[model samples]
Target: MARTNDDVAAMLEEYADLLAITGGPDFKIRVYQKAARSIGAHVTDIAGYDTTELRQIPNVGESIARKVAGYLRSGTVPQLEELRGRIPAGVRALTRIPALGPKRAMALHQRLGVDSPESLEAAIHAGALHGLPGFGEKTEENLLHGIALLRDAGERVHLGVAMPLAEDIVTALRAVEGCHRCGYAGSLRRMKDTIGDIDIVATSNRPKVLMSAFVALSQVTEVILHGDTKTSVRTGQGLQVDLRVVPPDAWGAAMQYFTGAKAHNIRTREIAVHRKLKLSEYGLFDAVTDELIVSKTEEEVYQRLGLPWIPPTLREDIGEIEAALAGELPDLVTEEDVRGDLHTHTELTDGHASLEEMVAAAAERGYAYYGVTDHGPKLYMQQMTLDKALAQRERVRELDGTSGLRLLHGVELNIDPDGDVDWPPDVLAGFDVCVASVHSHFDLPQDRTTRRLVRAAEHPCVNIIGHPSARLIGRRPPIDADWDEVFQACARSGTALEINAFPDRLDLAAELIRRARRYGVKFAVDSDSHAVGHLANLRYGIGTAQRGWLTADDVINTWPLDRLTAFLRKKQAAGVSRP
Candidate 1:
């Protein structure tokens, strides 16, 4: 079976974890981890390459390439199997708990005989875990909370995690000789934050050939079924991908039926039924005459139903169908509409790229402006002190006009638990823009969190609120807050809320965006990029905006450079300096 880049990366990650657990050489552990990182970030299919080409990848050396080849050819690596035998799989799972690292988990297994989340939870509840080295009552409490969140999060894969694998599979299907068209359906097409399974639809004359090609792809680790028109397989990342081959004429109807929010389809069918028309995966037909009417394209289907074409991202039956009927459907924000990125980082703090490199990447994307907003002092580990911030500001000023792209010097100011900002007014005033965000106290009471956010929005120097919910998908729940009040506060203070585009942190989720829109609050769809490759994350943010029914005019970053600067200056002029 063909293994995707993610598949190889997952195996390497497992090897690294096992090595760490077994007290293997530090250098070997680091090598596996680095190789995993590099492969996971790679855009192309790693399994299609020969051993020599694999070795050419940045972190893949001779040993790693050989291991990859061995795994791809057979099913398992001998060393990895041996390590698994030495360490129970349960012990590895224990390391995933919030406060537990491999070292801590191993110590627990060796001393307290704990090997899984169940056993650890038992120990904590029995008060047997409190006095352990590096662990206390507070740590135990935190672990319990983390475990609950993990349980609640369940097995859903983040959209970011599943998208690349889905795209690769679609590309492979499209390469089949008889395949006329191929694309993913389901929630992926709808752009949901999390996905349970991937659904792909293809139009092909030779179903068997397409099915064979799909099942034989390197990413398929297990074939669940292979039939004339459908095939299902499980990828290395544990994602179930189901492919359906349909006649070319039924492509549109099949796509609409499969790419469903169920409720949306039900509503559409209701309209068809009322109009004496029938709708199904086959085609739309006149119910009385039993004659086919439309099926070739989705737009034709919508037109027959007296509605305009609905973007896939808004197919959730969340007022989209109604909007279409009224001809009020929004011209949703697209990647091309964004003129700049306002929340980004560089090497002056936690980012990997330099200021100039980041600017060049933005310019390559045709962005007229890009903001350099590194972490502020309160971030501690990656904090930029006042003097460092000033020096960076000067550096930005000196290079401002030299680059074709306009650079905005800014800081991601830390918002404290009680609603205090990291920097004083005068310091914040020196920057071109200020993005205030909550970095700590994620578990505060709802009222307190709302108050904290409201205070930040009310701050005169604050131009935008970054990652309003402060969520790390699959890892942490969103902070509790009165979202309506917070949205109103931002609108009142003219503070734009960010739709942080980082895959792991697409904050101000689609539902919240819709709610905020009611208050006439503006938004900024930002990449929150730290590296050059991260600049491409802007697409995810744009999808989120479209899902929320936002248009280009509703997002500040979509405005031209002059309008954006004028808005920032207006906010700064009204800002009150702190004592």
Candidate 2:
């Protein structure tokens, strides 16, 4: 039997509530909460551990240990099951939405039977929710608005998705007379965490021609707003897109104005002022003469001030220009640099695609090779045992020889709370690569959590650390851990850090990757794709690599199959016998 992180999280959450109800010590409740997180982040199964092993966990002791083991042995832990009966499932779901927390969910659930999104919406519509305590008109309206926003934003989308759509429009607009340069601007240009609208800025002598062309783009669902200098439309996906056109002479200034983080532009203007210049959408102007000075390109605008042109993505005022002046600008990662995808699941272990299908997808993308890693047996979902993993690997070998894409069969083996892989040493060794990840135990303290991952990285078979922090941006923060020590240990041990490209969990944020790179640690840009559509996120992963100043050489995936294989084999040879 294996326990998942969700199981442990639910259990500990129930236990903490029970402890509070029973007047248990505050620290004691904290322990269970921490244990739940640790268990959630545990790369392996918690159920595999016996009572003594569970007890040995940093936060778990005799009492909590017994509870955890009991929970693993059966579908329900006696204590938590009893509480689940009391708590409405709808209340729990409420906490899952952004901008809402458990306390708010609980209150909404208890007051108006808002057990689900539908019910909450109904309550809001009828004005029934407004009468509840702490529910004023403003709060009620805001909640309703929040719910609508969340409902509208049903799925995650990024610049990659929006860029092509925008570019296609730009291509058409470029054909119009007088069009000089056209590209996406705004958050899409800055590579912000998320975007609601696409902003396109075009420079040409014939602004009217460009603007007219934009209004007629094929993807436009509805023309929301249109004008000579600017035009906006609603795309089929409910995104608002706005386009602006300006004269060529002011193209550089116009681009700088449109490619704004507002704050970054403000700073740039301040810098211009310090240099006795006036900055605007037209160009840098002479302060005393009130005349346009710099022109031609955005690069020229920046170069006039002794700064090199900053890539649109690195335009955020995170020391980009300073680094630029010193010739130390971060070498952002690019799509062509990624050599392999380390964390892909196949039908063998809860992946939607068959092994062959997985191989074909990678081959089609021209990936040098990919690690066909799937979940190992632990939790109930497609519990792939050692025998299953080996069989999958053998099939992968046959496919690899003929598939044209290098296929390395591996498992997303779980590490138990006691810091052990789900399989025996021999079993792990039989594979080409291993990615040790924490699927459960998300609540562990900084010290214990760091130790758990360190233990996994120290394993000989493990080639890469998958989704090191397990954070889903704007949804869930990564578990609190000593990042410096963890990255340092990974660096010393020669483990590669993964940049998971799932839009929600762009784990190993660019900043972290940059820091890790300073220590000479390598990175893998993985889609952690569960489906074919997810493969496209590889570019987002590459963008992260680029923002981190990573070069193709710094990425293992960019290595040709031969070099990548050698890197993996080298790790295996250096590893000690698995305990």
What TM-score does each of the candidates earn?
0.73, 0.67
Residue range 10-53, candidate 1, lDDT tens digits? 99999999899877899889789878866764434566577898
Tens-place lDDT digits, model 2, residues 62-171: 88888878877875677776766777665665655545665667777767778776688788889887558877887776676667756766454565566677778778
| Full-model lDDT for every candidate | 0.86, 0.74
Using TM-score as the measure, which candidate wins? 1
Model 1 CA lDDT for position 528: 90
CA shift of 481, model 2, Å: 1.7
Q: What TM-score should be assigned to candidate 1?
A: 0.73
Q: RMSD to the native, candidate 2?
A: 13.4
